[model samples]
Target chain A: MISILKNWVRGSNKLERFWLLSKIEYKLRYYENKLGLVWALIKPLSEIFIYYIAFEVIMKAGIPHFVSYLFIALVLWNFFVESSLGTIQILATKKYLYEYTNMNKIEIYLSVIGSNLIGLFFNILMFFVYYIFIEKGMYVSWHIIFLIPIVLNLVILSLGFSLILSNLYIIAKDIQQIWLIIIGLGFWISPILYKLDTFRAALPGLEYINPISNIIINARNVVLYNHVPEWGLLFWGLIYSVFFLLIGLYLLNRLGSKAAEKL
Target chain B: MELNKEKVAVIARNISKTFYISEDSYNTVKKRLFNLFNTPKPKEVAALKMMNFQIDRGECFGLIGRNGSGKSTLARVLAGVYPTDTGYVKINGSTMLMNLGVGMSHELTARENIYVSGSVLGLKIKEIDKVFDKIVDFAELREFIDTKIKFFSSGMIARLGFSIAVNAGAEIMFLDEILTVGDIKFQEKAIKVFEKSWIDGKTVILVSHSMDVIKKYCQRVAYLKNGVLEYLGDAETAVNMYIAENK
Candidate 1:
């Protein structure tokens, strides 16, 4: 485990690989499209517009400051959904890469995560532009910096899930369908669409157990309320991320070689 | 670290790997329905059974075997891509090259794939950077360096992949019929690179169907039959044994 961790960190210069892969990922997505990177902005903006109409206007939820709340949640939710779904199929999707080359399995995991992050970063940049300029000078607070930790935790968690699911998918082909169901179920349970305060009265126990709930709630707290993350919940989220990461690495180390054979 | 001046670089002692071959693919509904009643049974296939051999440092070893002979299984085991069911592998240095260009993405450019692929072979970015230009020149894809590899022909991709693997600078290397791709000119260039790497004291293990390639490059060779090491000795002897048995 020590050797594996050592190799993961110092053994591979991740920064260089990350930069190269991120660029490649971006280029690949926009390779033939004339719109190219403009889609990055257009995509989220369109999503926000649709959601705003359906949830805020039509549903007529009487919550205070609902537009800003929905926009912020959308930003966070987009990162989570994109990263998780993207990461899940990364290994299986790139099976040809493993079959034809001598590249490390872990790097594939990193590349997907890195690629998603580039998109996530651009989304965040756009989010700020909309929030500060378009939304008419929403008060900027230092707590927005909390996005760093949130992004880091999301990356680790997404990678952990990707590694496990991808490896499992190799062994069990039906996992892709199972994963889709789980994600669909997870979105409702998660606080992405709803505020935790609304749920806290009915299901107080869920706040402790559901890691994503905590992440979403904390992100909202920092961004909307200018409050720090709850230390206990933060600790739990870290534990969840770390535990999944270790499990993912263990599976990768054990079965990564057989991936080519099985694929 | 001065390269180990010894003759033997890799020694596999009674290495074996067993794989569980499932009888059939089960859809989610079927698997769930079946799980409610009983667990599904998978047939066990012994992919490799107690295979053993030794390759000297700087020696180019050849493994010639027909499909389902466990040639790829052994290569994966040696590359630490799979753990052995039994026995072990002792290596003096890193086995850098295995299945070349495995895990590369077409969405990535030739330059980007090099780093991702190189790191998998344990090559640092600086080291890859040093040989980056040389690799591009060798692949002869300088014009399309920045273009996404998806745009390149399969042969061009193979050429770029081969260049990176050969130049990744591992003391030990494994090639599994990866040369079968690319044109004759590229194959010739690849052979020259293989020869140069071998002369520079890099241990090479090559699996190929071409008898001429085996005889010309490898000093020692092994033949695997039914997941067992059937023959091991001089390349010429093994080739002859393989030919006689197959015929």
Candidate 2:
């Protein structure tokens, strides 16, 4: 424990390095494009618009504040997809960072998640803007502070999944293709466009089985529905994510030694 | 010369690394399923055989061998980049490896590369800010500081990388052919830096084919031949052994 504290003091420099690298990574993504950072808002807004048209206009789900409801789900889910999927090949792609310098492996994973997080922050801000001015949902309340832990949960979950996938990728390149299919199927299963209650009613065990489903339900309840979050589901979601993270870190420690040599 | 704990900068004990390369790599579920009953045995390549060595603090050590001789592997193992398969390596201080600038992102500008590499080497932003101009000036990339390094020539890239290492280097540096690139003028400048200012009190493990460099800078040299430590003694004997084996 004392060693960890000592490391924290020594690690101030590492944290700074992590922030700088992540910022550069965030900038480099849109460095060549003329639209630049506007793309961050454009990509998600277009997705939301398409879903808005399909579910609300065509299907007429008749859920009040449907746009805000869908917005919260998509923003959180997209962060999971983008962060976890982006880091699958991180061991090979970011080999230079650890291979050449005395960088801790955790920092490499943090930087990838960090860049995606910058995008998530922007989308969350846009969600608030739409909620206040455009959608004008009458649900804003003190419960909004709950978004902090919710976002932290998402970040940890994504970081955990990425750690597992990136290390596994060194062994089998097919994990990428396999994960793509899983994520595609995962989107529809996770109550993104539809109401969580409808999903739980239909699937019955989705709230317990799918962490994303729980997150979306709780997030919408707090933000869109103006109700207290489902604490039991929220706790379950945290447990699932932390569990995945621990397993992922263990896999990395075991398989990550071959990273520099293989990649 | 009495060998003591205080004088040692690096120590390797019975270290070995073996890599298993698949004959026909199967990374997907379908291929794995098809081959489940008939899995092909992987071919093993022992990159480093049982090796033991100790490097003293402030000493310049030379590693010389032919291609695939495990010089690079030993350097990496010693640098803690690759894990040793059987034994362990202990390093006293932080380490940085330079091989034609491995960490510089081509997407970033030279200025950004300095910050990235400097930060990775454990320099604070303020410390990097102080030495930023020196890195640019030494590399003679003042004009192309903001230009993406992908546009820069290989020589310019190498110069930029070497300059960063010179300015914001770790205590222990593993130089893997950093001097082989760049033009004659830059090479001369690099040699001057090594001679006058660089190797004064730093631990350097230089991996190069140039016997002249090995003879000049290294007080002791390790000659590896096919993953085996063939010689570890005075630079003159190792250089002669390497030259004789080349014939």
Candidate 3:
């Protein structure tokens, strides 16, 4: 238990190091693009538009309030997908940095997440502006405050996934190729585009098992429906986040040092 | 935290690293199916074998070896960058500068890289800030402090890297061929900094091919021959032995 506490403290300190590196990442990514950070909102907004047309207009899912639901879900899901996939290549791409510094491997993992969070936060903030003020039709409520905890939970999930993927990619190069396929399959399995109620009756226990489904649904409820998230589901998602994070961190702590040797 | 001045700062015992040289394990599916009926091929390489050493606090030690002689493997093991398969490393206070400018991103400005690189070396931002001017002055890139490091010359990059490293204030420092950077003037400047660090009771383990560097700075030297510790004694004798053997 004491060791766990020590590890927690060490992990928190490593997060600060990640915060520092994320500044570099932000600078490097936007250096060539003249539009600068406006590109963050532009990219996600474009993705939302494409998915909205495909699912709501063309496929004719006939789901109620499809536009608002799609908007909220895509914004939240974008954070998780971008963070996890970006983290897949974190250790592999930063091989020179890890080989040279005394920095913790966990820091490299978290830095990618941190940089993604910056863009994710911008995207989320824009959703509010577009829904509340610009559209001038949707209602805004205090329940939107639920986004804070939900975003935190998403971060925990991404960090956990990053821990496993980064370390595993070192041992098996094929993991990257396999990860893309898994992520694509994961999108279908989760309720990113579809409603949980649509699948809950057919799949029963399976929909609840996917924590991302609960997170996306909760985010949509707060942003679109102006309703508080279901406490039971929220609690389960938090538990899963913690569980995955602990397991991932354990594997990372055990295997991270071997990365340099393997590479 | 006060340190024991006379105690051993780093200890390595029976350290070894083995790596597999995989050859075409992912043959086409049809070919893989056919290979099941044929003899399986074997491919592997052991990078390091049973290396061991210890360094007293404030000692300036040198590591000399030919290319692919496992000097880097030993350095990585000491830095905790690579986990040892068989042994353990007990380090008191170590910071590895394994490769200069490896951590700095090209897009970040000089000021930003200082904080990022400094933290990676285990220095707090406040500590780095205190020495910020000195770091810049040493690098001699004050005119372009706000410019992105990518725009800087290779020499300037090396200067920035070395300056940040020197100011990190680790009790034990490991440098791998960092002196090969910049011009002769800058090299002389770096040598002065190294000498000053030694005088201030810092333990420095320098891994370089420059016989002159090893002979000039190190009080004692160790020769790594094919992942084995060949000799660890006087600096002059070790350099002579290395030169003789390679010739």
Question: Which prediction has the highest DockQ against the true structure?
Answer: 2
User: Which docking class does model 2 fall in?
Assistant: medium
What DockQ, between 0 and 1, does each candidate earn?
0.41, 0.66, 0.43
User: How does candidate 3 score on lDDT?
Assistant: 0.77
* Candidate 1 residue-wise lDDT, B78-159, digit = tens: 7655668788876766665445454567767787788767765566778888989998898899999988888988778778
Give the 10-residue window scoring lowest on summed lDDT in candidate 1 chain A: A95-104
Number of the top TM-score candidate: 2
TM-score of chain A of 1: 0.87
Off by over 4 Å in 1: A1-14, A30-32, A100-103, A254-257, B1-11, B27-29, B35-41, B65-67, B90-104, B109-133, B140-157, B167-170, B178-188, B210-212
* Candidates ranked, most accurate by lDDT first: 2, 3, 1
- Per-residue lDDT over B39-148 for candidate 2, one digit per residue giving the tens place of the 0 to 100 score: 88889998899988899999999999999999998999999898888888888777999898858888889989899999888898999999999989999988999999
DockQ ranking from best to worst?
Answer: 2, 3, 1
Indicate the DockQ of the complex predicted as candidate 3. Answer: 0.43
For candidate 1, the per-residue lDDT at B221 reads 88
- Write the residue-wise lDDT of candidate 3 on B69-146 in tens digits: 888777777777777888887777546654665567676789988887777766666678899999999989889999
Query: What's every prediction's RMSD, in angstroms?
Result: 4.1, 2.3, 4.1
lDDT of 2 by residue, A226-260 (tens): 78888998888899999999989898888887688
